[model samples]
Target: MKSSEADMVFPVLGFTPDGDIWGFPDLDTLTSCGSMTLKKNMQLDMELVDSRGRRWLVRSIRRLGRARPLVPWLIDLLLTAVPRFRIEQVLEEMTPLTLEEIKARASAAVELTSEYYCAEDERDEILVPLLDQVRAASDVAQIHELLGLDSFLSY
Candidate 1:
């Protein structure tokens, strides 16, 4: 491949979960191709339309860094439950912190939560147990109830 074509295959701001480089065309081409690659890999095709009304196929790949080992169960547990109210309640119960401090804490919490979901190992272990604790907390239950399941359940 010529340098130009090679450049098309690889674009800027591209990194895989394992820290491998993913090369693509220019930003537009990369965006188009990333969608195609994800769809092909996932065996599910979805239509993606650009602002100009051009249609493209797409798929999504879950990328986890070193934090890959804790995601799925985390998603299944916490993400499935917690609502915004519970989050706010937890924040309030933890004692009044400044908004900036709360944001920082929330960000860290989200990162840890995402890490738990991205984990590869399905087996229950130390991390899983701790995550389960968070999931099982009363605040989490309130959040789940607030979110509701009526739409998800159909008669």
Candidate 2:
């Protein structure tokens, strides 16, 4: 089932590398594919706080596998100076789906990513708890809160 238009706030959904997923509450601040009116390349400047309470400006590239290698090279160069670093490439467009849909997708992504980097024992200890949080969230706000973005965004 589709989500009500009224329930549609922000279209840009963020997933942290550390296994937290959140959607921006401020629709005005989100630069979603559906909202961008410009023809030229657009840059999404997103700010997120890690578990350590350190703030990070995560620059997302809308078109993946299309940018000149120099762009990412430059970003890598810049990250050398900053300890906190994150990079996101838009893999697909955001669909207007219910919270359940979002959760399912996020959970699947988390599982896939976890499988890629985790050992067998590490998977049970780390991946299970993260996936459980996504499954247990009662609402979008709860998901954001569980992810710790609610506190991060407060400041």
Candidate 3:
């Protein structure tokens, strides 16, 4: 790929679990490539869209960076039972930062979804807190309640 096209791929501000996890979504009306939602935690060749509508996959990130649309993240989907994430540091920090703080640094990168149109702003508001909760949560059922995802997760 050309340098410009390659730039579209990385130095992503990846928010991930502290372990090697992978997934699709429970409330999956917006999953990438349509219809891989049943695969559970396997790393399929799927696109990941964040709540703010960013898209890409956990592995898509270049050694340098960071996405698709406005939907719940795949990592959260991977571990439906308990959602959690820490910034996957391409540049290690002395101490870890919170999702909100990292979002602040990433600005439009991770905070504002890749302009999916409707619900972009709302996604940011709903997203951070939900992810924070994901980091702390211990049950899938509880995560579903974050945005009434239970409506879909249970379906």
Candidate 4:
């Protein structure tokens, strides 16, 4: 079933190395993809149309900025400092979706990215450290462990 804008609750989705997820329903009000007119920012939209022409919206988007890692790391530190980090509340605030849903949207995003940008042959240049975080971790537990406080505390 296609989800309309009304049916979806969260608009902004972001992830931390510690597998911390932040869902901001009002992010667009603060930061925006800018106008859809600019080719540069168009891909920021989570909207994707499938082969069947069904539109699917991905709630989460990778945060891009120089301080992306530092910001999430700081937030994680502050959040963990407060002991009562309820998993249920985290899950509720996070973008909750089935594995299939995540896969579909992820594939769609890759498709769009691949189409827009040319792939580089130099493996080193192509390999992004942030993307590496997602690629290296196989599961949620692994992601959290890799992104845990111990790692951030070092830096």
**TM-score quality measure for candidate 1:** 0.18
User: Model 3 misses residue 17 by how many Å?
Assistant: 20
lDDT order of candidates, top first? 2, 4, 3, 1
Evaluated at residue 91, the lDDT of candidate 2 is 31
Worst 10 residues of 4 by lDDT: 83-92
Question: What local distance difference test score does each model get?
Answer: 0.28, 0.43, 0.31, 0.32
User: Residues 1-115, candidate 4, lDDT per residue (tens digit)?
Assistant: 2122323333333333323232233323212231221222222333432222233344333323322256664675566542111110111222355434433333333334442
Winner by TM-score between candidate 4 and candidate 1 = 4
For 60-155, candidate 1 gives per-residue lDDT tens digits of 333222111356534534654421110000000112233233223323343344443346464355445444543443432222232221210010
lDDT string, candidate 3, 61-145, tens digits = 1211112222444654455533222112111222434444433433333233323323666765765665566555433323334
Among the numbered candidates, top lDDT falls to 2
Distance from true location, Cα of 25 in model 1, Å: 4.1
Cα-based TM-score, every candidate: 0.18, 0.39, 0.22, 0.26
* Candidate 3 local lDDT, residue 144: 31
Best by TM-score: 2
